[model samples]
Target: MSATTTSPRISPVNPALATPTDLSSEGVAAIADQLRDLLADVFALYVKTKNFHWHMSGPHFRDSHLLLDEHSDQIFAMTDELAERARKIGGTTLRSIGDIARHQRLRDNDKEFVEPRTMLAELASDNQELTRSLRAAHAVCDEHQDVATTSLIENWIDETERRTWFLSEIAGPR
Candidate 1:
């Protein structure tokens, strides 16, 4: 008997994320690639929210602080959801800061601090990116015939959009 192991980096290396239906090697590979990207996007958003929560300052100090705290928590929760979903799909999450740094489309919060409006704008932008990514994930799931994941991602996209709308509204009529 011979045993050969898969490349862990190729994803879904754990049973928790078994493909909804057994997929072709090529389908698995493609789905895994998208899952990796989505994981990176989520991690980046989580980190960005945390960063803004810590460094934001200005007139809305108390309110902004509280909101950021809640927002960061939401992002963190999304991170867990993403990782578990990746596993459910037989894809491993790319969950390092380095991975996020490399794959994130959003800009880093490089400054030591930012004004309330800056924080709001940054947060909204990241949410928009996340929404777009989730929508794309829905499309991928549909393509893969994975209605379960598609439904999950559709909810995520809507939630992100609601959050983005709130943040954008607070930032004022622009």
Candidate 2:
């Protein structure tokens, strides 16, 4: 006599597939794609900020390190909100670091040593770029009539602008 063997069947599901969202598939896709890019850039910036924070050295190291840590935390906090916003709209978001690398447009600095001034300047430039990207994404949200997303983007833009201002002040002529 032989024992019978059986296996449970599993179905594959595609999260990227368009679902029944209140927003149109076309609109959700467009906005979510923009949000994905935004998320990637924010994540990259967060990592870069943390890198500078950890490696900081100079007369102003104490202040700069603390500031970078605070900014990095703020940048990281945005990631969850961004990913959730995409999913709430029935859109797929970054799944892994690879996905972030693929979507991110921000450049990473891997130098063994970056001057404090240079770090501040670089972060300021990055924050400015992020603000511009946020504005573009806000436009997409407006075009798509995604009020919730638009509202969220508005808050992000404000936060980013504040970050840029802080960076600019810290990096000002010295």
Candidate 3:
């Protein structure tokens, strides 16, 4: 005569995780979705930057490596900010590397070796693309009246532009 035990009821998905905001659900979804994708691109760029930094081998190895390290740090910093911004506005964010890969528009670099100048040029182009994407996201924020996110995106755009400028200068007109 064994006593039968009843299973505890599982609670449904909590709505509290979706933070409240003045923006409409559509606005929140649009902004958050854009941000998630932007964050994915940022992650891709960050990884690639580090890859270049680690693999750097040239006469200017020291300078190129240092520059990529700094750039990768900047790019990595944006990931948390982007994720938090999305969460703050009542939307979900990337949960895994797979999610990032799915949303990322930036291509990955897996080559065994890339020339120093080539790396710089590729990174500059990627940063340019990232700048454009950031501007597009800013437009979405403007449409949604999300000034906070807009401000953050503005700073990120500036940073991306600066990175591009440095890389372009170093790579010399390419």
Candidate 4:
């Protein structure tokens, strides 16, 4: 009954973690926020594309599956670049699948059976939306003089548009 107990000390949260970056803290923050959203959307699309790829069937199964796999790989490749860009600019990025779900603006298709044409159409629409968002984010980068991010976004926009075109062609006359 005479033993003394000591409590562990907890450190206070650091405000510096939220401080502005060399590129103007406010601007970096705004751009980072947009990038975070973009990353989430891309991740969601990647997952959806992969889902279609895995479940694809029908006369065009081989081609559709291959195309989705390629698209998913392309979308996945951007996730690292996006997260790193945010961190490089001293901005926080996604940490988990839950984080991506929270930030994603794209709709997910969980249906057991989606027609190949429908999958192509849905993915095309999503890529179009992503392109629009990328353009808007590019504007933010321009406003903040974030040339590095702007340059990257420009390439991504082109890539996304190309993906959209491919999807549109696959979808065919609808």
lDDT of 3 by residue, 1-174 (tens): 001112212222149686878987777877877887899999999999999999999899999999999999999999999999988988878889998898899899999989989999999999999999999889888988999999999999999999999999999975
Top-TM-score structure, candidate number: 3
Residue-level lDDT tens digits of model 1 in 10-39: 533556545564765545555566666777
Model 3 shows how many backbone clashes?
0
Task: Record all residue pairs in model 2 with backbone atoms less than 3 Å apart, i.e. clashing.
Answer: none
Residue 70 shift from truth in candidate 4, angstroms: 0.8
Candidate 1 structure, TM-score to reference: 0.82
* Candidate 3, poorest ten consecutive residues by summed lDDT: 1-10
Worst 10 residues of 4 by lDDT: 1-10
Q: How many backbone collisions does model 4 have?
A: 1
TM-score: the better of candidates 1 and 2: 2
Q: Candidate 2 — what's its lDDT? A: 0.84
lDDT by residue (24-49, candidate 2, tens digit) is 66677777788888999999999999
Q: lDDT for model 3, on a 0 to 1 scale?
A: 0.87
Q: How many backbone clashes does candidate 1 have?
A: 6
Candidate 4 local lDDT, 1-174, one digit each (tens): 000111212122136755445687667667778888899999999999999999898899999999999999999999999988987877777889998898898999999999989999999999999998899888888888999999999999999999999999999988
Candidate 2 regions with alpha-carbon error over 4 angstroms: 1-19
* Cα lDDT, all candidates: 0.69, 0.84, 0.87, 0.85
